[model samples]
Target: MKALRVEKPNNISVVEIPKVRLEKDNEILIKVKAAGICGSDISIYSGQSPVATYPRILGHEVTGIVEEISKSVTKFKVGDHVIIKQTESCNNCYACKHGRDNVCVDLKVRGVNIDGGYCEYITVPETSAYKIPKDLDFKTAVLIEPFTIAFQACSRGRLQKDDTLLVYGAGALGATVIQVAKSFGCKIIAVDIEEEKLIQAKNLGATYAINGKSPTLKEEIQAASENYGPTICIDSVCNPKSFEFLVDIVGNAGRVVLMGFDTRVSEIPQFKITARELDIIGSRLQHDKFEKVIDLFARDIIQPKDMISHVFHFEDIEKAFDVIASKQFRKIVLTF
Candidate 1:
């Protein structure tokens, strides 16, 4: 099978390795159809992601067809179209036992800690495979994984319909957050450094788009959020100081969702936290959201095709990465 492997930092290629097979009775062999390249993939390629292991097959947001299934598999069968749930955890861990396996003590995400679905064929536990609507194209199905992140974020932030929501970063992940927030009937303020991206965010259901580079950014956000500051803020930008900036703007008793893996220390004042009774949450991969996201796509409740900026053949992955340097794409997918 052909697997797109990052040989080392700044070195990736289409390499032929021994094909994967169903190593466990609960596993199913997937013929990968489409995979979305996440920012983490670029991080791994450039040797920036702290958790990424090199010589790795780089894809986690994936959609595929079940080519074969183990005898023990009952959740799916041969020829089932599925979107993968890429999280891995030890069920015996404390977090897992508490039904929070998304933060399992020994969590390992495919394509980072292990090889992922950026190949001609891959095999995974049937537990990781959720069947997609037969009519949903592979390219659009791949967006479901990103939407799972959006769902998890909203869940963590306790998003409510009447609350004002402010989202930072109008890129791929932020776009999903805006769309999901729309489903909750919340007023959304989309923030980004790019004008075009902000425009796209509005098209995707953002109530207002504010350029982060604007000198009146705070005032603008205050206006859009009804002069009381937002009740919930999701920061997809993940900059070192994002914590402080968000804390200064969110209303009292509000929640701030942090999605980045940045390691820098933030100087958020303890007084501000206590006075506002703020909730600072860190949202990771996803927790039990694949099924909900699938339903959203399957029912045509959310437009997934609009999320795609470009599609490239699996072999032209280098070209796709080049597009990332332009800083203009939403979701870039690789077709197998």
Candidate 2:
């Protein structure tokens, strides 16, 4: 099998490796069809991700066909099209027992903490595999994982139909937030430094697009929300500066969800948070949202294809990473 491995910072290559086999009775062997490159993958390549280890196979957003299944795997069989839920939780943890497995104390995210799907074949536990719609192509199916992040963020922010949402960043996750917020009937204000991404956000149903670089960004957001600040703010940029703007642009009693992850710590405006009674929430990976996102895609509520700007082959892994680093596209997928 051919797997794309990151040996260290700024080092990645496609290397021939032994094929994976089912290690547990509850595991299934999948013939990877398509895998999406995430920002975390780029972080791993550049040695920025805190959790990622060296010589890791870097891919987590994946879709595949079940090539083989262990005898104990009755939920999935051969030829079943499935989407991988990269987060594997130890069901015994307090969080998992309380229905919050996404944040389990002993959680392991494939591609980040372990080997992932940037390969010809991969093996995962049956519990981590969900059957995708047969009609959905692999490229689009691969988006379910990322969409789940957006969905979880929106849910965490307690987005309401009557609320106005201010989303920072118009990258892939930000675009997903726009689409999800739109589905909930929330008016969206998409903010980004890139005009191209802002345009893409508008096309994805953002009611307003504001340049984060603008001198009066807070005023613009206030005006967009009819003289009141946004009722909810989502920070997808993960920058300290964006975090500051999130606190500044949200209305009194508004909810702010931090969806992006960075190691650097940012100062929190304690006075504003207390004076306005703001709710600051942190959203991590998906928590039981994959199936719902898949349904949304099936019903055309969220079109994954529109977000896909580039597709590369397994053999062109280096070129793919280069393009991802360029940040010119919304989403990039590697087809096996």
Candidate 3:
């Protein structure tokens, strides 16, 4: 089987390796059809990702065809179009037992902690793969993974129909969370420095788009939220400064979802946390959100096509990364 792997930091190539097969009764073999290049993939390629291991097969935003399945795989079969979750966890872990397996103590994440789908074929437990609409485009199908990320964050935030959400960063995940929150009947205020992305956010159901560089950003957010301030804030920008800004901007008793892994020391005032009694949440990969996202995609409630800005063949992975570096796209999907 031909697969793409990073031999080490700053070194990557496609190599022939043994074809994977189903070895468990509940397992299925997926023939890779498309995978999305995420920011983590770039970090891994550049030796900047803290969690990725070397000699890794790099792809997590994935969708593929089930070319083979064990007899016990009653939920799927050969020729089924499917999207697979990227993480596998030990069922006995404290987090897993508490339904927070996305952060299991012994969590193994594909593309970060283990081999992932960057090849002609891969195998996964049947439970991890969910069937997509048979006619769905693979490029769009790959977005389900990211939608899960957005969905998981909203879930963690405990967003309600009456809540007003303030989303930092109007890129792929930002646009997605806006859509997801909109589905819950929540109003959204999307903030970003790029005017184009702000416009895109408005198109994706954000009630307001404020320039992140606006001199009166807080005032604008207050107006957008009808003076109550946003009840939920998500820091998709994922930085210490952004975290502090959200803590200060969100409404009293609001929920703040943290989405970054930066280890920098952030000086957060304990007074704000105590005075407002805010709910601070740390969201990781996802916790069983694939099912919800897949249902949303199948029902046409959300458009995955809106999130994709570029598509490249699998062989042009290098060119794809170059395009990313040049900053000319929103999201890039790689075709097999």
| Count of residue pairs whose backbone atoms collide, per candidate | 0, 0, 0
Q: Taking the tens digit of each residue's C-alpha lDDT, what string does model 2 give over 191-261? A: 99999889888999999999989999878888999988999999988878778878877899999899766
Candidate number of the best TM-score: 3
Local accuracy of candidate 3 as per-residue lDDT tens digits, 169-278: 98767888888888898889999999999998998899899999999999999999988889999999989899999998999999999989999977798899999899
Give a tens-digit lDDT track for model 1, residues 243-327: 7899999999999999988788999878988998999999988889998888887777798877688999999987998899898
Where does candidate 1 stray beyond 4 Å?
Answer: 326-328
Q: Give TM per candidate.
A: 0.95, 0.93, 0.97
Q: Model 3: clashing residue pairs?
A: none
Error of 3 at 292 (Å): 0.7
**Residue 260 of candidate 3: its Cα lDDT?**
90
lDDT of each: 0.90, 0.89, 0.90
Model 1 residue 306 lDDT? 70
- For model 2 the TM-score comes to 0.93
- Give the TM-score comparing model 3 with the true structure, all chains together: 0.97
Q: Sorted on TM-score, highest at the top, how do the candidates line up?
A: 3, 1, 2
C-alpha lDDT of residue 117 in model 2: 93
Error of 3 at 74 (Å): 1.7
| For every candidate, C-alpha RMSD to the true structure in Å | 1.6, 1.8, 1.2
